[model samples]
Target: MIKHAALVSFLMHLDYFDAGNMDSFVDDLTVIPAGRGTDAAGQIVVCEMEYTGVYGIADYPHVQYPVQRLLAQISAWLLDHDTDRTTPFDFSVNVETNPRDDSKADLEIRIPFREAVTASADAGGELALAGEHYDVNA
Candidate 1:
């Protein structure tokens, strides 16, 4: 979650936004190759997001998200509003799959969308989760 904003900003600066017939930064976007780096808490929500539009894949780019200092704000907003945000999100191309334990998520998303996706599930069953919910308490 913390790296989300930074990643987004970087992508944007690199021209990662869709604008009519303009060139898209990424060919496609989905949730098959990312969504890792989440907390061990129950309740994990995986939202399929993306940033399109870019001139071309640059040779190199510099970016920052200030995860340490800004993560709290993002987390606070989620917690304050009771939103599920256990996974560290970022705009990506193709599809990616994120695991619940965060031990290892197959970072092999080169396609659009994916199967066997993990979702946000709450501990103590207080929050009912869908799909393959990863139990942080476990």
Candidate 2:
């Protein structure tokens, strides 16, 4: 499982937004298993995971440039930190204005990654599984 607090901290470290703004800007942060597939050798199960959240920003004049820059920065950060080269990294973003505050909008971001896991089971017995969870980009 990905820790929301840790992700928020990572974003703060990027300096795009300040600590005080975190509570207002970031929400519903989570990492979930999206799908699973076996590797070429069939020795490991590759699980596709998605890290997603809604980032709130002030909607104002000339806001497009900043939003674009923010997206680029996030993409770079993800590529630099959590990529394995063999697996493709994918991300998507959607913007929507807040109903309560037209001046505010949210950037819904989704980043996907692959994780390897080992699974085992015995007849009429319990199933045992183990996996390593990657941080941030993973």
Best by lDDT: 2
What RMSD, rounded to one decimal, does every model reach? 15.4, 7.9
The TM-score, computed over Cα atoms with residue i paired to residue i, of candidate 2 is 0.44
Candidate lDDT (C-alpha), each: 0.33, 0.43
**TM-score for each predicted model, relative to the true structure:** 0.21, 0.44
Tens-digit per-residue lDDT, 62-122, candidate 2 = 2433556767776666566555434333444455534324333444444443333333232
Model 1 bad stretches (over 4 Å): 1-24, 33-38, 45-128, 131-138
Model 1 lDDT per residue over 1-138, tens place: 223333334434534222221222344444444444455454343433432322222221112322232335433433443223333342233333343233322222231212223345533443243434344332
Error of 1 at 34 (Å): 9.9
RMSD of 1: 15.4
